[model samples]
Target: MQSNFSYQTHDYFNFVFTDDGSVGLYNNIVGDIYHSKFGARTEAEEKFIKPLNFHKNFFKKKELNVLDICYGIGYNTKAFLNKILKLKYKGKVSIDILEYDKNLVLISPFINDSYFKTSPDISYILINLLMDEIFNNKEEVMEILYKSDNKKFIEPFYRRLIKKYEKTEYSYNPVSQNKAFLHNIYYHYISQRKKRYLKLPKIENFYVRTYFDDARASIKSLNKEYDIIFLDAFTPAKLPTLWSLDFFEELFKHSSEDCLLVTYSNSAAVRHAMIEAGYFVGKIFDNKKHPCGTIASKNKLLIENKLDEYDLGLLKTSAGVYYKDSGLKNSSQEILEEYSQRRKLLNLESSSQYIKRNKRS
Candidate 1:
């Protein structure tokens, strides 16, 4: 696929690979949240990777399913996996992903393999090697790579492979290596290189793949029955269709009673949409003293977040629209005001001094 990245973001790290030999990170995980090339341990951990771990601890469940909306190069997916495995989630935590970009899948090996190669574990190389062997029709590839097999630690990776990897199917996949080039690349390189992990964030029990274009088109009622939904689409501005309020309402229809819908956005319109969709919405634990980001759910009295004041004020604003209107030909003050009045009529506010103070702030 061609590189559609027109601009690079300094803060967010974006990893992109074109089949035409351009492998670079555009550095925007949408807005200023993360960068691709320099995936700092702090931001990567705080915003995306670390948050998944936080959920593991915060929720304290053995098996949790996370539906990753914008499953990009899958750094977040791998990050979630690394954390879950570290936490030793024995029950099973599945992550279903929806990604439409094939560029991510195709060049993932070259770039991801390079990243994993930096780690000194021979088993890392061996498992992905064995992965290649399974995908390929090679008769003795795993045996050949495991020839010096005195290492006892790697036997688990092998056993884990049967219990999970080789047998465990992708609910959402990168792409099949059925093509000649991919197959040949696998067979040729599996043994020679140090073992690497596509394991950026991999869950043992579940991995569901979804196409980007089809994501909107394929919004089935059953799809919304997730425990947690990671709303990681590109952005509402760039990808307006994905962030529509109507979709939120549809998602709410399928939501579990205690489900938490999470995302990196703190947008007024997006928050408004969640409210319109029937979620008792608020900010998530931003790790700072103040609450940050958004989390919407069915629980009316879920923990009040840092965004309580800001969002409450917006609901009372002159520009208070439940969500950005994609149906409009143009957005103007008049349109916003119209929606604001509509919201006002719906009694969307609580009369509190905190709400007034939030407006002033």
Candidate 2:
């Protein structure tokens, strides 16, 4: 018997604060946590950032373009910023991020700097301040604001910030005293002025554009090449649209010759999709967890410690028969049903058999 107000409160309540002070969400419909219970920021650093080899690669490139997929709460994006800022790279850095859920975007401004205690370098002070004003009247903004409220409030603020700071320049290694070096946030769904590209505020030679559409459709429209691609989407079983072979093909097309894509999933299906989409694949090692992620790149030299023979063997089994969207428009149920039928057609090896074979090999 929860009222509308209660339902709204419930939505906010679903975001639970972790030990690191970073927030994690409970997906009520899915009965799962959006991020790992261990730590959200921790996972972003250990799983995505470290594996990217940013320090080694950033200096070699004149400009670095990043595509952060399903950019939930902007953890991976922020982590990327944290790394590059420390290195003090002077080259142009651009990020094209995708997020389907507007609620997460709306909630982002409310998340204070304290929420990212684990990553103190990524301050959300400006974003939090703006969000505070939007909800100043509380009731009025809440009532008027829905999913579509983005263009009205969010986009304009971002535009103004970028315009205000577009001409500013900085040293390759600027002092920390510069407030402009802190951070700037921008996101969009379309390609305007040759790819809806909006230069990020304060930070010199930085640009960002956000896509509010589903990754499957939006990613295909991307014409620019990227250096680092962070696949921070939901689980493959739950969110198949972003992990499908068709989607990976779009990624491969938009990626630079040496572009490297990282994901916190060691899922065989994801690996299979990446391999099938024409990329050298490898594992992302974590000291706290098992080989916890997969990295894919067009250049074989970029993929350090590629999946060994035993791990590659897993792809031949049922685990490798990844999900497909049948032209990238099928619903999750439809995709699952199709995958189920596909599984039935193959005499795939059981998990135990695969393990036994791997151990023997």
Candidate 3:
């Protein structure tokens, strides 16, 4: 990970490096990766990104098996848990954290103002794991899901309480402003916050999972497609491969009859990629910053919010680059350029056509 990054809207600064080379937030007891420059308390209260935070209204609990591809230090993971916790449902909700660089995770706690700064369990784990893994060089940290045989360790010890089914009780609601209770809530939010992650939820009509890794590998799992997919990764500027049409089609191949891939970006390249990937991409609920957001699916009716109004200029503006490779092929500048040309040609064709922007806005 890069040593520095600045928030687009603010001059706020965060030094993400820790002494041990962890990629996480700091000053937290339970060890959460800072979700954004705003830190934990504020984001939690405001419900993280306001628009993205509320999508749960459209989804059912335990019914969605989410995937968090970048699982970096687990900030978003924690935020996601908080959201569902609010919903209070019981279904099979399982999230897999791909810790490609556990070192970044390990060194994260000491960074200062980390989301985990206030949690006790994270403090304990950070110490215990440091003793076990850092100084001792032991790999005792394994997936809790795999070691459910020890109910005590998995439950109260590590917070993996596996009940017979999913329910609102699975969510760890913060009961107080008490520092200690807050700590427990934070830790529970990370490990204990689940309905039934016992086994990977079967891909089906009712359940949609988040894919947190490279979209290529994620595509294979589309054997059971999704009703809703939170298509989040770093913007394509950093990882172009994730945005390509090739990966989108892989998701399309296994999609349920009505699937909606929701993402924050309204980048034109990504929009075009969805089209090439065989999805009928449409606009989302963007007021203006983004002329249109994306809701792509094989089934057009799946789109919840469609952009009926349009400013002809957006048809040609440079939205952030989209991933245009529609199949599982290697993407290149040439491929993106070719797609750009196509978009230009289409825009020219539509230039004579008049459309209305939302008059109300």
Candidate 4:
């Protein structure tokens, strides 16, 4: 099982430090960062993993299938792994990841492990993913992760962040708390330098299969009814194809009866598409208990924060107009153009007008 992509990091492999002190990758091609600047791991834990209500759903099943779309640097999946580890879950976990760029998957293990607060078992899983998807064996993966100069990949970014923190005076806030946390982790990393050679955990029953192709094409090959679907696409405006009505319809076919499709998108267009595809949608609250994303499922009981009248009404405005890709075969530009033309033809009010009307009342 050899990969066609090379292991060498490219010139565009630039890393940016987020406000929460987690590393974020910038895609030169897309002109956007992969994770939110608020935090990479933070976004995954809060927006994706926490919203699952995992305690209610995970323990009920002996086996769980997860579909992770756009598995950028494997943050969402890694966050899930961290949570299940804390819970000491004994069930078999299978994940099918769809990522267009094989290069991103190859470099996933090189990201600083400390930022994730990964356990030894979690590190083993990251190494296993690299072994299965790119390398021939575990030794090759370990050599790159530990023995090679690749271990220094994140050092430059870490030093810059430390220096930036030294100069700034942060007030009592969440950002200050994150800065303190990173400082503690940095000190711990230095003290545990000798422990870097710890033995890897024996592989568990976790199964991961990665598809390096357009999600629209890769989704068709999936055979399992996924229990959880993490749809962390770029954005509806930048990449509408994945957020189209047809794409949601395809997801509906691949979902189990109680499957929860979670995404960091609360866009009216995206929600409208999900509702049109026959799924009941609701808001995903942040740690501060604010509506941060969307969660959709066939079972309405799974949604805790149901969309209110104002939120539902927003769908009827121009912002609620969904991107269309009939047969799931249109390009991004084509879909955006079609969506724009449709919005022009409709007599619906603008989203701004809707917001203003609600605020006055």
Candidate 5:
């Protein structure tokens, strides 16, 4: 792996500082930020992490499996790692992440640590220590770093191996003790991905595989089942391939019986696609006045918060006809135009009428 990342800055991306003091990439072609302006890290935690109830789930099972789609900037995966460490989970985890753009992963290391910061606890303190050592300096890490144990708390590896500190290097071999340890494991994984398809270097208790190709095609070929699926792809309007009806059907095939598929989308089209694909869809509410995202699961009990009458009505209308990519062979324009023609033929009630009809009197 190379230490110099100066030449890897993507020309198609415009890095913008987000409201949460984190960096977000604005795709020139898509014309949207990779994450919401509310806060990239906060959004991942609230939408994906808390909704999953990872701590409770970790305690119930000796192993955990996750499928993170889009894997943009590695925020969702990094947040998951932080939460698991904070929970002091001692479980073996297998994560298979689908990322189409390799450049996003490459530039993630240079992203400020503020994006990784979360609420501080003893577990979080231990996480801070691991991160501090990984980056070699506390100052270079997140500003939220708290003073805590110097010994690393890498669970499932009870034995602590303390070694004399050495100058921090960005290469694959950063530490002398661990021949494979790098300053940042995720960053190392990205830097080592020199080809379109590459298997990531294994981390203790964590096995991650990155597929650098079209997600629609990749989802079909994946033989493994997922316990949790993170749908973090671009919006249907901007990138419809991943949100098509056909794509969700393929995802359903690869999902476990008890799988919880989560995404930051609450669009009627998105929800309709999930329901049409046989998933029991619900709203991933964070107790805000308005719901945040949607979570789909095989079990209805897993959905504590669900879509209201207005939403359900909207889904039945043309508003929820959804983009179609039959046989997974349609282009974005094709899917968009197909939905447009379908809506015209349905002659459905407007969204406002549905909202008015379902209004809570």
Candidate 6:
């Protein structure tokens, strides 16, 4: 429950401001950032939230269950809460989040921006998690939230939102009032009108349980079936254990029949592994309506865009060779080494070769 790294010193949480003004953490060890530079909140909205079509599907359910793997800073979950709040969804929500680094969970609430500032419900959920899982007392949590340089970190982004809102006319429609609505909330929070501004009743139906452990082990212990699963792991080359066939099989077991497992990875190996795991896989389009990620489910009808011929052909190439973790106990190095050996032994056509052959045909 203790983190040796200090946020003030930028020792562990190497914060980077993304293109969309949201904060992201750079993992020096992984040589990558935790979120996309395109936009952290935007990525979560387009990749994870939009694809699920919660309004047409899950909103009808009396209770919704979600499992989020690799829950770094929880942008995906935050985006989810924003969408549901906008939709005025009343269904009970239960989320099971798995993250190996407790530090990320500890730092999540402090990393603020306009995107998160507007969504008070996210703050509420995150604060509750911090108290329930990280700290035993509310005083410790309040000290971190108020005493830390949180205001300094969020002020610039919050000002930008204010300027944007000032330029636009206020409207009554939800879509049109988005900026104005956020402006009001931000003003309330900054004005220290806590009694009048904080809306606890809005999120009373929301429940979140966070497991600070290896996702491989945590998934095994979860007995509940989830309606939606967000797999936001690192790339297949960087961390192949989570993308392995065995891992997907386990996910397939935990998934409800119509459950959609979404990830921001469009790797051929990752999609092939999902297919082999007995799930119907499809492509997830980005904001521009271009294919950017993969989605898988037990129900074929749930997949809107099925794999086309080119996609199916690519699966036969060397790039389609998936990593294996039979017992889910193998290290990343072991998985990568085993994958290399298997690729060489299979002698499958290279992805370039497949592309060139398709062009000739």
**Which scores higher on TM-score, 1 or 3?**
1
lDDT by residue for model 6 (8-93), tens: 33344466677888877778767777899978878888999999988887888888999999998888888888888888788899
Predicted structure with the largest TM-score when compared to the true one = 6
Tens-place lDDT digits, model 1, residues 193-277: 6454333323235444444433444454145466667676655545544566766876677666766777767667788778887
Weakest ten-residue segment in model 6 by summed lDDT: 1-10
Candidate 5 structure quality by residue, lDDT tens digits, 39-152: 787788889988887655446677777888998676787777777765767777787768766555433433553633332222222232243334453232222111132112
lDDT of 4: 0.76
Q: lDDT scores for all predictions?
A: 0.48, 0.67, 0.43, 0.76, 0.66, 0.77
- Candidate 5: the clashing residue pairs are none
Error of 1 at 198 (Å): 16
Q: RMSD of each candidate?
A: 11.3, 10.7, 12.8, 10.5, 10.5, 8.7
Candidate number that wins on TM-score, 3 or 6: 6
What's the TM-score of each model vs. the native? Answer: 0.57, 0.75, 0.50, 0.81, 0.75, 0.83
Give the candidates in order of lDDT, highest first. Answer: 6, 4, 2, 5, 1, 3
Question: Between the candidate structures 1 and 2, which one is better when assessed by TM-score?
Answer: 2
Stretches of candidate 2 above 4 Å error? 1-13, 112-121, 124-201
lDDT of 1 at 28: 49
* Tens digits of per-residue lDDT for model 3, 140-208: 233222234422312242232212111222243332222233334444455544532222112222221
- Candidate 6 local Cα displacement, residue 84, angstroms: 0.7
Off-target runs (Cα >4 Å) in candidate 1 are 1-24, 27-44, 49-62, 109-204, 221-224, 285-292, 300-306, 324-361
**How does candidate 6 score on lDDT?**
0.77
User: What's model 2's lDDT at 82?
Assistant: 75
What C-alpha root-mean-square deviation, in Å, does candidate 4 show against the real structure?
A: 10.5
Rank list by TM-score = 6, 4, 2, 5, 1, 3
Worst 10 residues of 3 by lDDT: 160-169
